[model samples]
Target: MKHNVILVVLDGLNYQVARHALGHLQAYCDAGRAALYRLDCELPSLSRPLYECILTGVPPIASGVVHNDVVRLSNQRSIFHYARAAGLTTAAAAYHWVSELYNRAPFEAVRDRHTDDADLPIQYGHFYYADHYPDSHLLADAEHLRLRHKPNFLLVHPMNIDDAGHKHGLDSPQYRNSARRADIILADYLQAWLEAGYQVLVTADHGMNTDRSHNGLLPEEREVPLFVLGSAFSLDAAVRPRQTELCGTVCELLGVEHDKPVCRELLK
Candidate 1:
């Protein structure tokens, strides 16, 4: 079974950025499945709600984490909580609002509010931070966690490219360059993991629009990539084209029985 799952959420990443970073992402695509889909939601695509939904395998309202400031009303356990319950060690590296919402004081190790140099480690549970983009330092830290502690779940969030894209617009060279850099960083990190015989799952929390404006709910904003690597899983050959589905797809891959009532679909 694919016990060790590494989730990479690139905040505000779009298809254009992905294509620009194609070289870096090639290995991930070649190694496993690459499913692209339209997010199909409203505008102002905020990070907290989307991420929370991804984690809990529930919609934003059910998860109760919508927007950055609005916290979930109840305990509202997440994938991390479920992972812990299942006896899997969980670690996270998030940025911007994800770190603020998920990485609480005692349960997580968080870093950096604006810059991309934040690198913190968690002995157990989850580690989250918001670095501008992917970095060698963060990749090294993840490797250490996997090699030294062997955590079952490790989440890494890279924000620089997304920040640049939002600030400078997606068409700008700055956005393209940032995407390329992120791709390279991801390739290097995955190389290390593969060398260590580790399986990797690379994906995004949501996609961004070149328009450079969002209110947290839109199809473009919600649609994201779901790429997987390693020897355990196989890319559905019939489903070569991009497709969309609820976050429960991830739950299925990890062997976690999702409580929400929904039929599972693959990218076909």
Candidate 2:
């Protein structure tokens, strides 16, 4: 059977927080239905650069998206780009920076907010500008796009955790609560997606620190959780994965050729 894939990036989710807080995702790991990996996200661990790293499999220094302020169209081929090149549909319900990276540069809220352009890497997009935009709403938008387009590759990014971390330190109740909320929300749709034969990967761009900021080499700021659910994965705990391998892994799941390196040991 042909497989579809969904990549969910829960921004600013720390590995220890996910191991402790995300009960729903943990249940899957406990039941042997999902594999959980501790990944150290690329350095200069900010959002946009990590987003670029996650999607393009290129590190910030090489990708030239070293900071969140450097907003422009990405030069590297993303999973969406490879999927589209293979005549597959792609969709994303994510931050505006995602739209800027894969769809257009300098995202104009008026022109790029809700896009449906066949020529773009993300053929269907629901991009939001506000960091405070509710995760519930973003998930709803992703569900809407899924039902409407049935895209071969889907990207679902939510910002609430990151926003909470920026406002409150990573150790605060607010940050933990945000991760819990996202886990609760995922429980609503994950079963249906799995039943529908979609390969799903839930991870983070980067982690947050107790200092209420990132862009450091600290484990709390660099390590994040990766939860995988699908037949393509082996759930082999021995095979550690890096953030850069996500793009290649997704490309392989979609049966597309890619130059990015993949974590082959993690796959059956």
Candidate 3:
């Protein structure tokens, strides 16, 4: 069987935010097809390091990304690398770090220029950044690629939640609204992808805290959601998987070797 996966990362989504604002997201928890867990990403919990950890299945310390100071990915293993080895097409539209790390991601990557960047032209990908790009342009771009390239592993990451949380702590209405908007966005894309025969994973790099900014010892900053909604996973068997176990899961789905002890087949 030709297995496919679509990973959607909602940055800086605290568990409380999801629980309170994302009523739509609760469907995944009730659906037997989904496995939901509250998993701690990594220390620092910054976007750069956490996302690196997520893609590489290694902590920031091991991945050589202790802070947001770095731009490119070094010689390391990532989901994209595994996908390529298995002859699967891959693509992503996310933050600049992603594009910078993989040189347009080795397949196709949009740096997701946000309007928040003050209209600075993206030097890498041709896609221009806009403030409303996440809810509008990003989704359109992802759908276009899905229909055109049919990549086996596609990642769509939206950062509005993070921005909102940073600007107006998680308790603020903006943060709550961002969470709801994120849920709607994910629901729309997930439904479309599932209808077109794709497994979907909704997870986050980090969470927000009482403080307007993230990155601290607080659990809110470290713990994030990890929800897998798919057809291959047995509804009868559910597992609380660690963040590092994702590499093995992807490798298993792609029919490749992933012998890391932290990696395991989480499905039944």
* CA RMSD of all predictions: 5.3, 0.8, 5.4
Q: Against the correct fold, how does model 3 do in TM-score?
A: 0.85
- Report the candidate with higher lDDT, 1 versus 2: 2
Ranking, TM-score, top scorer first:
2, 3, 1
Question: Could you tell me the lDDT of residue 7 within candidate 3?
Answer: 81
Tens digits of per-residue lDDT, candidate 2, 164-207, equal: 99999899999999999999999999999999899999999999
Leading candidate by lDDT: 2
Task: Write the number of the candidate with greater lDDT, choosing between 2 and 3.
Answer: 2
Tens-digit lDDT track for model 1 on 1-268? 4456777766667654564465756645654534333233322356667666666555556556656567433245555555655655666656535444444332223333322221322223223354454455655555665676666667776677677767877677877787677777777677776566555656666666668645544555655555556555445544332222333444444566546432243411
Best-to-worst ranking by lDDT: 2, 3, 1
Per-residue C-alpha lDDT of model 3 across residues 1-268, encoded as one tens digit per residue: 5578878788888866776677666776676657667777777788878877777777878878788777654456777777766656777766656665554433233324321131111121223233345755666667766786677877777788888888889779998898898888766677778878787777888899878888887888878887777777654334557777666676666565555434344554
Worst 10 residues of 1 by lDDT: 114-123
Clash count (model 3, backbone only): 3
**Worst lDDT window (10 residues) for model 3?**
115-124
lDDT of each candidate versus the true structure? 0.55, 0.94, 0.69
With a 3 Å backbone cut-off (N, CA, C), the pairs that clash in candidate 3 are 113-129, 115-130, 115-131
lDDT of candidate 2 at residue 36, scale 0 to 100 = 93
Error of 1 at 184 (Å): 0.4
